[model samples]
Target: MEPALDDIWREVHLDGLKPVLPLFPTDALSEQSDESELLPDYAESDMNSAISALSGRHCVKLENLSISFGSVHKQPSWTMDPTALLDVLRQNPSLKTVTLRLPIPAVTVIEELGDLSRLERLEMRWWKDPGDTGTTGDGTTSMELFPSLRNIRSGKLSTFRRILSYMSTHLITWLKITVSSFSETQELFNMIQPCSALKSIHIMPIVPLAPTISDPLDLTLSFQPILKCKAMENFFIHTLNTVPPSDSDLTSLAVAWPKLSTFTWSSLSRYGPQATLEGLKTLSANCRSLRKLDIPIQVPPELPKQTPHAPFCDGVTVDIRQWRVDDAVDIDRFVGYLAPLAPRDGTPWLRLGNVKAGVWIAVGDRLRQCYD
Candidate 1:
């Protein structure tokens, strides 16, 4: 499968993942990979040297490993022959999950990796090194690579999208993807539209190659695409780069995925209008099977009018962490509004209560006081 122009594989170095020492320059991390002539994480060694290190590993049988190599200032000397890498993988047939960050055309890498008979999960990222080589459909064909693959956690859109096209979508049940742009988000939804069997998807905003969180995404338009995967249950987004979702966005999400039990999107922007109590009431009315709710919403000032007609989901922990409160708020008023979400009696044995402190701890304290 031919990847898009932007998703080139840069580096996948498995440097034994040894952390650099205290004397390592912290300043190199903040600089973009291209700008940093010699990244602190990479030892100024060549590809043969990296592979030799892997050859000397302590484990005779390997299960999972992540190896990547790339930099903007990559020299002509930073060469890799996938033949050597392929030989190494051939030795370790027990490898079930393999993460590669390499500076080569994905076509060459995937074609070479077709020999790996037992790899089940693949994590691939393009590191933007000078080593990549390909033209349109150059030097590769549609050979079924990673035959046993199921789970895929890709850092680049092209990497995941290309893999999905080759594999049987029905086989994949879980996905943890990091999308860097809105176009990437919408495009990914199109890819998952056919993933009817996908049970859980964890979406993240930070790009693996860069140090910064991507530009803010408006949830209204951005989230509409993935609603096609009706089988989703544990829906989560590490939405640090997103504009705090409006109430409409919240309810639309709730109504779309009725099966969601462990729903969470923590650390929203402190500024902007937050999702309010009324919005949450609508959420409770629509999606009743909630077990853990962890969004930042405005807690009401007084006893919220929880009518007899209101939908209540006891045996749940609404981990609305550290919410913004104004005025002298009575604790009872807060608990009354949140009674529908209180933990059911005898449910503490599960220990599903949130560990986050600040506002939610006090509210969780009230759940035992007023509802229990």
Candidate 2:
């Protein structure tokens, strides 16, 4: 097989060999170790050979390219030098997406990829290194290098920041970031404030592996900065710590994103910044395009006091946590009175109830299914 591979390389045409899956049949079983037999086999040498054979295909149009590097025993060893990646990109002028894993020394050299005028999406994953500072310099970040980029997903917060630091905010429409541990969320919002074209953002903050205290750290989460990105359609802020928003916060959000269709503000029910029914009403009234609303609400004692009107709309959804469980306020009677006011159509179909089985179980179920 080695002699045949050498013979094939010697017969390359002027346009170079066309790229194909390098792992031939029967070779997969031989490549895996006893412990790794259950895992998908990777043929690094074969891939490199195939890439080398196609090096001359300068006009090849590839849609996606995935490259990884690390110790073969402890990690997947698909490591290629950034320069080699650049060479591949240069050869494939029509490349649109690149997914990279692990760290590439002097990765900033990738800035040369500005030559790939058609590149649009860049995804980097499994970066656990905290000391790797690629191109996060003090200089102003300019997205001109990857002007065509629309979506970016990064596993490391530092890596995400380093890449986004140089990108023009207007070119990015979608960003999904998972950070290891951060003291606060203020810095994140500050960094993303310039992203005028951002439409959807999903941020997940993980706990730090090493902590100074034995107890869980308390962190503050704020979404006020998101108001600047008026083009936003969906914003998911998931955190391990509870950070709820207040009625005023929701009103501010309503004003900020009048076009918001889907939103998830975590810890609203069990945490701080608790909102009232009025805030939800304000959100529904302002976000005319809103279809689904999920938040934590403190069921007010005043709910039974309000007049219950009949349905107003045909299709809207609302999900909330019934934070308060008061025996005085009968769940059935309370929901019965508010059902009329809980209209569908332009109105949201509110899913409100407590986390545990409460008296409102039957009422909440009816509310969630009433729109149907």
Candidate 3:
């Protein structure tokens, strides 16, 4: 015998009663029933209705919500209605974090999003075509709309610049920008300056559109503005196809970022070992606040029989040594040289060195303890 819809609704509405409500009509409530459930085809109107239904539902106050739009479904025409969504959010002040991966135009929605005063964290990716500037209705660029945004991950330099400009006027605490072309590098440095609260920056390299013949010295000057940001404590730069500048260039960087505590450089060798080592020395000298260092140290085919005397400065305690040597003999000799340099206080020291069979491992465990 099948249950009547009104009877089922009465049972569900009973106080303290919890029922397994199915979206589809079912004739039987028997466990393991084979009837296929049918869900109403979702539509724009259905979504709007659901939002309306949940508006006053006090239980709907969400701390975090993630929305992912499917690529197959035709985007609802009303999905572009940011004003309506903003009003709903304004009504529900408890919403704290929102992550959206949808097709709605970012710039249009961002302007409406500024009203989310209670929002603490937001992640937005602008994948839509930033419409032609010549278009009559496009009021402002996407950057202007997201002035209050503290974090962003974008695919284009133009978009990054727009966001950077906004942050300069307002204030941003953290920023991440990925560049697809080397030509965009200078513009990135120039734009990053205004973010006074910026604490960390990560640069992932893109292939150069065309190689420029700027002198290595000029390359150092180009990066000075980025190092000038006072709030930056951690910095990382990685390049794909482009050859890295010389040690002199890195020295210039160390000089510029005197307050840097953590620094990482991942770049292919375009210069010789001497230059690389010289750059590292300069970095060590300039970055007095440095506590962590991750730099590639290239080993030459033949190393000097005697280890070089690289004296440690006063008041320095922690030392982490990472070697990129390829040969076992060179690694052995390098470790032998560094063992004595380890601070006697036994602070944490990390070493990545090549051993037999070309495997790299940390052989500094005992040495680290000895320093402690």
Candidate 4:
């Protein structure tokens, strides 16, 4: 062994210099075990780089694939031809899930998605530059791109409607979309008419960060159509407006979706829509199956002088109050009120404070100072 030391060192050095292996090897690397090592993708690479890696491995079956561009937005040089990506997808017939975060070509990409015959789930985020022509006021209206995208951040309401129209026949069970305008809200209601297969719906504002459009979110009217989907089990809506749904609307929700186990509704503006304690009580009484609640509601300033009663339902596991760190008093009130109402076995969490093991007040104080 001492005489062969030079040869052993040469073999070890040579192994390190070998070319990098592709992601999915056709043959087993070792006979003892079949585990594969995690190979890192080049951080700066684009879709073309990915295609090149898998070019010859057409028979490789990927159960799940995720691709995200490292850059925040795509440059002109980085854009990949949409058809080329489709061509790669065609080769992977066994793909069951795909998640993409890239700037894809227009409407043509949506049609090409049909090529993934075995796909059961898809999540995509289209990157855009504020200066891009496609994002201009006139651009989205002229040509509808991202047909599978049900969510809209900023675009003509008509364009969103057209996009939904294209997806009417797809078998989608979960959906999340953003509505920016009141007119768009109406159109969204119309578009949701055909999606009877929906089991969970999450509605978020299109421009939640900077809302350029000002329209009262008519939640009552917008939500009426969603109630028709009897299969619904979970519903969440975030309205960046100043108007909260009224008690009647809350009652209607409880009546419409009695089977809902989780429900969340929030408002972006501080002065805008908030549910009353009465509305919360009504919600608890009606939605018998509700186990989780994330609502922007104002708790009573003082705990009721009367001894608190058990929550209307078996015991709500989650009651998320949208209290921010700016107001310590509001945070105090929310925790003081809900801690007692929570079931002994249930877990309660505050949006801005921690009430676990009776340390919520201290948590609130710390958060308030941090914000200040």
Candidate 5:
């Protein structure tokens, strides 16, 4: 009976182990074992030293490298030696993307940057006072640093133009410029003409005229050069606390941009609804390529209550919208007049009311939903 019991136990153990035995290395049992063995301390140190050497030699293959400056309460500064950094960049030829946030001198920044050959994308944020000296010791502005850069996002228009002028020989596919004031619109427009490959342009705070209240009629009329850039397909302008142009001005723009597909205006309240609608009429007449249109309306209280008619657009789809504050309850009735202008599919025409503090939160929310 004891032999029978031992046989049964042996059978059960063999049955369980058989399923896992094939997973073990068959060579381990066949190969002759070596008598020499490594000590754990030496093995670990050797492994660590080998890893360090390999890492030092092949560090350039990393996909993402971020260089950040600035602390909680202090403005950012790039304190590295520009010449040494340039040398490191030249050695790390595999780097494809670069993000720079620093306070280095613009001349040094540009000089070191011109050496990166494989770089495809670049994002840089540097501050310069308007009164600072303009040229490097080599007579090159900060713009010569990046000849291959394609996309640019900047807080100051002057810096953007400076970069654009340097890269005028290269064709940029996308450009976005944001400025707090409209004082540099002419200069910005002048620099934009040479970029013939520009497909999309967004001009925020479009100042048709400077913001000096002293000259209420101080509108500047020097956008003809930009209007002639036939390559422009998408144009967006956002104006806050600035006057809107007259009907003639809109008419001129429409005739100038015959290829424009998307045109948008935000926070435009310099004129009454009559002037706005008249300007829209002019745009529809001239811009035969317009497909998407956004216009914010600020109707005056004294204007006679009347229906808004569909503005004329020749064979092109258009979306005309009015945005007003909640307190302006009288504007709701005017919605009916503008309802006819809504796209037959219920998309082109949008009516938004009850804006808060000149920020069209409700309109923005709805717009986001439509795009989503």
Candidate 6:
């Protein structure tokens, strides 16, 4: 509709180019081959036309624009030609939010994005390649690409490391990224260690989010670098596999982020060295803003004589079903220490799957009495 409504405020959404089916079957594929046909076909995107339409519309109102060529249902095969939407992007220099579901564009395209100093949010599907950073002979990636970006979502953790290398990103608020390897995650933490203005972070998977790694993920040690972001509010990590944090690890996290509203480690089930009742109590005591806490924890062998605090927030909920409690723990006393799991609506959330449901029922009963 660029022919009719060429205003700066008009939002544009276009379906990107489609992927082509492979001529060769799986059996014909070779691991050693470096053929372009072996690569996933990327959405060339509808930008070819959208760019032509908006090439002359230099309006400051186009704040949100979305262009895609790829889909999760039909995965692509073959490499992408660098982006062709440079002219359209140049015309709308003030675009604040841009979502390009295209493959990694040439850094030249990134460098030439007209004065996007106002760009606040940028989401790219495959901007994961930390492309040719050694473009400068001295191997410095100090390019001022997105100086004013506040929210960014990319496919790779290494890409963020490249972005955050020289960015004075104090205004950054929300960040989402997909990670594939353990070492990549460790290196990503290096970049995130200094940029503390971030509030919410979502660490997702590339596609079909599942447990692909076989090595034991040391979540406790990995969590150390994140503790540097003291302003963290909502944090989530999804790999479906992790080692339960020890009591010390939990305590360190409780002390690190006082404003932690939501914390999640999306694991199917975790075992070994989980937080005890004391660790849960410590978390509730310190993180008064907590609304949701998802972890694997256990009950104490014997109940403490001192009374625990009430639920820190109004509608706090917890899912700690992946746990093993002490056999000698008293149900009556063990129930009181679990006041933090109390939901605001007076009903407890029990996701028990045959791991002592009776004891959990008693725990829920105590939560009701505490919240009431």
Candidate with top lDDT is 6
For candidate 4, the TM-score is 0.67
What shift in Å separates residue 128 of candidate 6 from its native position after superposition?
6.9
| Per-candidate clash tally | 20, 20, 4, 3, 4, 14
Q: Which pairs clash in the backbone of model 5?
A: 78-103, 308-337, 319-348, 326-354
Please identify which of the two predictions, 5 or 6, would achieve the higher TM-score against the true structure.
6
Query: Measured by TM-score, how close is model 6 to the native structure?
Result: 0.73
By summed lDDT, the worst window of 10 consecutive residues in model 4 runs over 8-17
Q: Write the per-residue lDDT of candidate 4 for residues 268-362, one digit (tens) a residue.
A: 75454357656767777777877777766666657554355555477565455465444445555555555545444443433443334344655
TM-score per candidate: 0.65, 0.68, 0.62, 0.67, 0.60, 0.73
- lDDT against the true structure, per candidate, is 0.58, 0.57, 0.49, 0.53, 0.48, 0.62
lDDT of 6 at 159: 50
Model 6 score (lDDT) = 0.62
Please tell me which model should have the higher TM-score, number 1 or number 2.
Answer: 2
- lDDT (10s digit) by residue, model 6, range 84-168: 4776677777788887776545354556542677788877665536464532121134565566788988765555555554356
- Candidate 1 per-residue lDDT, tens place, 44-82, comes to 455555565444443334566566555423323334566
Model 6: CA > 4 A from native: 1-4, 17-47, 54-57, 73-75, 128-142, 207-214, 299-310, 321-372
The deviation in Å at residue 37 for candidate 5 is 31
Cα RMSD for candidates in order = 11.3, 8.7, 10.2, 10.0, 16.2, 10.4
Which ranges in model 5 have alpha carbons more than 4 Å from their true place?
1-66, 70-74, 77-88, 92-97, 117-121, 128-147, 204-211, 215-222, 239-241, 267-275, 281-291, 298-322, 327-329, 351-372
Q: Give residue 73's error in model 3 in angstroms.
A: 20
- lDDT by residue for model 5 (1-372), tens: 222211111100001112121111123222432212111112311323322222343234433333434432344432433443344445455555655544445444454556665555555545443444432122134445454566565545645544544544235656667655554555566666656766677776423444455533223355555665666778776655444555666677677677777776554544443336567666766676777666554344554454545644534443434454453244333443344444444444453444544345434443444334
Candidate 3 — what's its lDDT? 0.49
What digit string (tens of lDDT, one per residue) describes model 3 on residues 8-101? Answer: 2111110001121123222343353422231122343344333343333332334444443333223333344444445555555454565554
